[model samples]
Target chain A: MKIAKDIKELKDAISKFSGSVGFVPTMGALHQGHLSLIQKARAENDNVVVSIFVNPTQFLPGEDLDKYPRREEADKKICEVAGVDILFMPEISSMYHSDEVKLKAPSYLGYILEGNRRPGHFDGVVQIVMKLLNLVQPDRAYFGKKDAQQLVILQKMAKDLFLPYEIVPVETVREDDGLALSSRNVYLSAEERERALSISRALKAASRLIMAGEFSSEVIEAKMSEIMKDIDVEYIAIVDRDFRPLKKVKIQNSIILVAAKVGKTRLIDNLWV
Target chain B: MKIAKDIKELKDAISKFSGSVGFVPTMGALHQGHLSLIQKARAENDNVVVSIFVNPTQFLPGEDLDKYPRREEADKKICEVAGVDILFMPEISSMYHSDEVKLKAPSYLGYILEGNRRPGHFDGVVQIVMKLLNLVQPDRAYFGKKDAQQLVILQKMAKDLFLPYEIVPVETVREDDGLALSSRNVYLSAEERERALSISRALKAASRLIMAGEFSSEVIEAKMSEIMKDIDVEYIAIVDRDFRPLKKVKIQNSIILVAAKVGKTRLIDNLWV
Candidate 1:
């Protein structure tokens, strides 16, 4: 696998490829969730490009920008093992400049659920994603469903901005205990890891309720809240595929999303019913 | 030439082309300025696409958006004569949606000169241009140097965002009497048009001063102001190619820009020294 450390190097490397390119952009802790995205990209395209960028803009002032994981050696090995054609690890200085154009997330879609809890987060996501998409010019870009709101926002951005590439939604990867895999998972303590399992359990409980004919959002949310009561639950929302609030779950169109504080690390998980 | 009035049609039409595409995006008044851009596109690439969109976002509340020229028949003939392969004219509803992601211009570059006079104008310009560029996916995109600040801001956006297409800056076209060609030029009455010539005259006077070894921006601006004494000048400032204020002219790097109101019509012209 070829590793490009700069924009020019990556551009030059990508320009030589003649066939369809698939891209997987990540913040680079490289959990199984990210691997699923890369594996999908590898299976679908002639060239697979992976970007490992801990974009500073996406992190709010008090957020985990400084302490974000940077396991470059391990990430490179992972990319090599996954058959990535080009592993782009651009310096922050090369990717961003002082006083440049910025992308703003939609007011409604960008400020609900995850967007509400973390304001301006999606803006940074769209900003970096746009830059990456333009640079890669991939035929298809893979994003995991674990970040459900992010996936929806990105899909909206692609359509609204007329971006040509396809945004493939990969299923979320999970632990044997049902906790969703996340880079932030490394920050969890043993007790916190155990607590995080309730997030998935709450989602599963919601799923069971749905399977048992609990179509009303209010009842399912109340039930989810009870399941996550042992943990510090932030929100339990039932929304449609477009992220609009759902009064009643619509089976294939509904998503039951949960966010909570497992100790100090906030974790989120969802079930697409 | 094939005409596409919607996004899907244009996408299908463009997907069949196997060669380089050059694009010119306009608001459809069919002036010589626009024709020059199309002609350049036609010469440089295997296929040429032109889009006529009177972007409402770019217009300030009191500005001439509704009354902006829309001579589709004449514009179509011009594009056909210029060898344009495809002409895309998307309706406002088709191009825009409620609660969509938006692009914000840089605080500094987007708030000076015309941007200052017309707040949020560059934001809208970048927003629509981004959409159009994404839709066209051209090898090269053309813009006239007549709108110097817009061109600079767009160039910065392309570089900052890592856009794949080249932004070609075509020379500003002008009439024999020196009025810069613009779709807004049609709004000027015959007498107002004669007075509008001072905009170019002021620029020419600044050029003559530069040729005579005058390097001080203050002194040249003073001379430019004196030449446009009869017109209601909005601003007569000299700045660098990047649109930053310049103390003295830097020869190849300096730009002298002017904006003035002739009757109720506003006109802008510039000279790249």
Candidate 2:
């Protein structure tokens, strides 16, 4: 696979291929989750492109911008082995400049869940998404449902901006245990790693309740909360497809979401019912 | 020419024609300035498309959004006469929805000059430009040099976004008496109309002074200011192509801009030196 570090060079390289391009953008700590995205892109399009940019803007001040994991050599091998046609590894400078345009996520949709904890986070997200979408011009772009809020926001952005590409939402890839896969999972200590499982366990519990016809959101949230009681819970919301809160669950359209802090590392997980 | 009022219809209409498209977006007050842009688009591509939607977001709260002129019949005739193959007149509902992902202009460049006078203006400009460009999928898009600041900001947005279309800047259209052509010029009264000539006169005087070897920006601005004494001048700036201030004019790379309030109407004009 060809590697590109500059915007003009990457654009020029892609320009030569006048075909359907599939793109996967990542934060470069390669694992099964990222590999799965690239694998899907490689399988679906004539040209598959991946970008590994640990974007600083999306990380709020004091939010682990420096500590965010970076495994460049491993990431390169992962993409190469996955049969990605091109790997774009742009420096922060290549993606951003002083006095550049900015983007803001909607207040109603953005200021809930993840955004509630980190204000202005999705603004950075929309800005980078706009930039990356512009840069890639792909036939389809792949994003993991692991970041469910981000995926929803990106789908909204594509619809609002009239972008001519599909946002393919791939399901989250997890380990043998129910723990959700994440690059930041590396930040957890052994004990914290043990505690992180609570995030996924709570979602599994909620799913079982839903399957057994326990439809009251309040009852389900109470049960999930008891399981994650040790962690500092941020928000526990049960919402419909549009993210409007539902006091009671609606089968086939409900999502149970939870975010909790496990010894300085924040963990979030959700289950669509 | 075919008329389309939404995204699906426009795309379907254009898909029938297997040729390069040139797009021109306007606000439906088809003046000679807008005509020039459409004409250029018509000449450069196999098919030409025009969109006339007075975007509400770009206007400041107290700006003339409600009163902005709309001459649809005249505008349609002008587009037809110019050989435009498609005219898109999308409703606001079709173009935008609630909980939108918003775009912001580059802080430094977008916040000065026009941006200074009309805050949050370029954000709306970039927002619409992105949508229109995506929907039209044109080979080239045309913009008038009359809105010089707006044009520059749109170009920056395109580059930042990695939009596939080219932006073509057409020269400003002018009246016989040297007033820059604008649909808003219709707002001027007889007395205001006469005073608007000073805008172009000031630009010409600055150009002449620069040609006579008075490259100092102070000298040129001071002299131009003298000619526009009766008017309430907003800014007389000598700047480079990027809109950054230059102390001395650099012949081919400089622009002299003037914005003044003539009677109850505001007018702006510039000369590319």
| Candidate No. with top DockQ | 1
Predicted structure with the largest lDDT when compared to the true one: 1
Per-residue CA lDDT of candidate 1, range A155-231, in tens?
A: 99999998988999999999999989999999999988987898898888888888899899999998888878889
> Candidate 2 chain B, which ten residues in sequence have the lowest lDDT sum?
B154-163
TM-score list, all predictions: 0.98, 0.96
TM-score of 1: 0.98
Best by TM-score: 1
Instruction: Report per-candidate DockQ.
Output: 0.93, 0.77
Model 1, residue B250: distance off in Å is: 0.6
Model 1 score (lDDT): 0.92
**Which 10 consecutive residues of model 1 chain A have the lowest summed lDDT?**
A221-230
Chain A TM-score for candidate 1 is 0.98
lDDT of 1 by residue, B66-109 (tens): 88878889999988988989999999999998889999999999
The regions of model 2 sitting more than 4 angstroms off are: none
- Total clashing pairs in model 1: 0
